[model samples]
Target: MRKASIRLKTALLASLTCVTVHAWGMSFERQERCIEGLTPKCQVMILATGQIDKDSPKQFKSFAQTFPRGTWVAVSSPGGNLVGGMQLGLAIRELGFNTTIGNSDYSPPDCLSACAYAFAGGVSRKLTPGSRYGLHQFRGSDQAINAEDTQKISATLAKYLDAMGVDRRLLDYAQMTTSDKVTVLTLAQAQLLKVDTAGQTSYARWKVEVTPDSKLLAINSSLFTVGSQIPITLGILPVPGQNNKVACLIYYKSNDASAFSASNPQHFEIGKEIYPLISAGNWQEKTGGYQATFLIPDNLLIALLQAPDDTVITLSGSFSKPPQSNTTTASTNPLTAYFGVGNLKNSLQALLKR
Candidate 1:
């Protein structure tokens, strides 16, 4: 029985290796059309079902040349040929085209390993909803690269990322993921690195819901709990002067000192007024503006959202004038909202029970 089991294990290992080796080659089918309903000015090129190869650059350049400048190239690949991938990426960058991970049908797709290199070359990159970008350490057929050559590759990649305006920290993330296992970037990670550069309009059309007000606050979820954090993304108009700061103030009347004690900063001050920053520990600065996660428990949040109508949250700071003449009255306040007492009470009551 032991001898039979050993033979089965060896056979299965050989079969798995064969499958992996077969996936390490490249082929592609290119489709030219406006994908994702983009305009003709932004023609879309699709690279689906293939690995990158020595001729990949030539193939990409040929199609890219036919399109006007600033086209979008949608890529979906299992990854192949590291050298070829980099070359193809350089060519795409040279042509000044944007890149996304998607299919000709506008379906989401994966850009993994070698494919990630080419995707990074975009003048403006995007990863559509349901799409993913994955990475892993560099590798060769023998599963090892010389130290000197590896250093050169690292330097070259750093240079490319710098030129492409991508965050260098991405290299750290890539290296952290071993070659045999893929590291798929989370939505937050992709956005933080500017890998998804789809415009504000595109994003607004997606999952974001903007308040119909002079000051807008976009909350990812209306539901909240003490156990986890919820992100509230604020869109602040550019300030009048450089380096101007905005402070978000949260006010609540609490009898429970324990809840209040848990906050990062016990107090927040702006001029003469002071209030505790809610869930201060969860606050962070993001690419465009500031985001804060509400760390207060359901009951505390309910209290803040209700009673003492005077208790309120506000954003106060100097902000740049909106460019549009019609929107000149855009609020410098950025965020000001009053939660409905009855509705919030019910929501919190149900949430805490769960």
Candidate 2:
């Protein structure tokens, strides 16, 4: 709808409809690597490289079945089949996987045109340093397509981007360039458009609210998990009728129905200290996922408040089980979601003044 010149090529549409033998499509390969972190552990990584076609999403789902949910998917593609690329992105997002623009060897690679759509699907998208994320106008195979059809395709693409938390302005950037050329975005621009989210741990800032009792105070912030960016709200509220006393809790809500399990071990980590969290015994099952709460120890809550503003607090839990394999010992690698204590002290001080 933006412009009559912006159109999808019938060739790409044919790729999705016809049952013809194309040269080659996307390939999904699995590899195991020792991930270095608080605990050095062996993790399975998926490498998706090649042209994204109609079959790519299916291929990815099949290949990803054996790996854990937070597994990394490194993609390197020149782009193909726009609809197929969006479908592949949806699959990635559905599985709660992380995406990056790279190859199996971890070399920076180009994720251009339609491939960018698939990249957008990542829960945590990272553009490798030196990697190129380019977009351009869609091209067809010399088939005449009407304006109405093109507008529909554009609208669908816009909706997909919005669902993925990407800026719709990305489409404007794509339309600005012709299909024959690519418009590669700089790191700053990519971050501005939310195509990349490296080092972005918190989704929401600290918000202070008055409890229903009026005398008690509640402060909450939304922190995201490391790989998938699963939102976990950290809430600190005064204990009822306990003067200068507060209780802490973490609330996890996800659209993925299986996102959290009561049996899984969950904890909060600050520096060398590990504080275990127990289920608050409150659970609500929603349409697609569940919402649950975990209670934080009073000591941990005090530590969090006293800690430096730049201190990073991790919310870890065994969210997924490892695949059964002889080469790798099956272990529950806890999800390492963390957030910095940015201006929390100031917010608390301001709240007290209020």
Candidate 3:
């Protein structure tokens, strides 16, 4: 049955019946077989189980060239080389194909470790019922890594997952498990981490923008329950056709009806950086466009939410730019991109009381 759309291909690659090469004494094989009975308007290509090595990407490329865009790539394998898996995964993403754990006969199979990584690169990915999906840390042959190398690898992996719209927390959870012991995620966990997108067509997102016509710097911050320490992302977009810079100093203070008080200072930490409720003179620079992210502190976050229902935090920030040479007013028009609560005051009140 069709879950998502895939383009029909004219040419098909033959499934490999024999070993094409060997790596570390293990024979490697790859196959591309077309699923019969599909309509001419759509197609499914099954990539048979085999070890992924340096040559895997080359083989994948040859098969992919024969197919049209949006083909569903059914992958099943025990997983092998990390480099090869990443390369093949990137190619799958670039080709805009979807991925599933199945074979030419439509039988589900094991897609573990590096194979899971390739599956993740699919524009849309799914794990069929009865199919086994496994994951673990990216490690070397020795199954050990230096602290420096670990940090670098984590940063790169997180970035890749974020770009793929997969939850970066999957990396964190994977780090807790060793390579020898695979972490098999349930379908619920997979859906939570954005690893499984079957039957899902849309997701809720939050964003805030300020235009020249409206410059209140009004932030539509998403309101969560008290003591919820979630990440907050703020973005700044420049007005078109001008040399301009926009900057913001965020301030979260408990406020009465009349004024805001910063006497009880607070701090929010995200990643390795801590941002004070009142920003330091070192402004967050905005060259073309700027984005800043931070995690709300549990204690301070409670204060912001648990306070009186009428209490509000006045967000203060500034934007500056040099005088424009041309008469265009584009420079003055800045947009602040952020998430807004449906009803800022009312929503927070309801959430905090909950």
Q: Which candidate number would show the highest TM-score if scored against the true structure? A: 2
lDDT of 3 by residue, 1-354 (tens): 000001011011011111122323112224443433223424446454666665776677666776654567777766676555655666666555667777434323767766776777776677777777777776655334668766765665565566455888988666887766678789899889888875342112323445576632324331111111111233222223433322233322111211111122334332234445433243232332123323333444444434443232322222343112112222221211112222333333332333
What digit string (tens of lDDT, one per residue) describes model 2 on residues 127-155?
77678999887755456446775676677
lDDT of 2: 0.63
lDDT of each: 0.48, 0.63, 0.47
| TM-score-superior candidate, 2 or 3 | 2
Steric clash pairs (candidate 2): 9-140
Give candidate 3's root-mean-square deviation (CA, Å): 17.5
Cα deviation of 169, candidate 3, in Å:
1.2
Residue-pair clash count for candidate 3: 3
Native-to-model Cα distance after best TM-score fit, residue 33 in candidate 1, in Å: 6.3
- Write the number of the candidate with greater lDDT, choosing between 2 and 3: 2
**Deviation from truth (RMSD, Å), model 1:** 19.2
As a TM-score, model 2 comes out at 0.55
What stretches of model 1 exceed 4 Å from their correct place? 1-21, 24-44, 104-108, 200-354
Q: Which stretches of candidate 3 lie over 4 Å from their true place?
A: 1-43, 104-108, 142-144, 201-208, 211-354
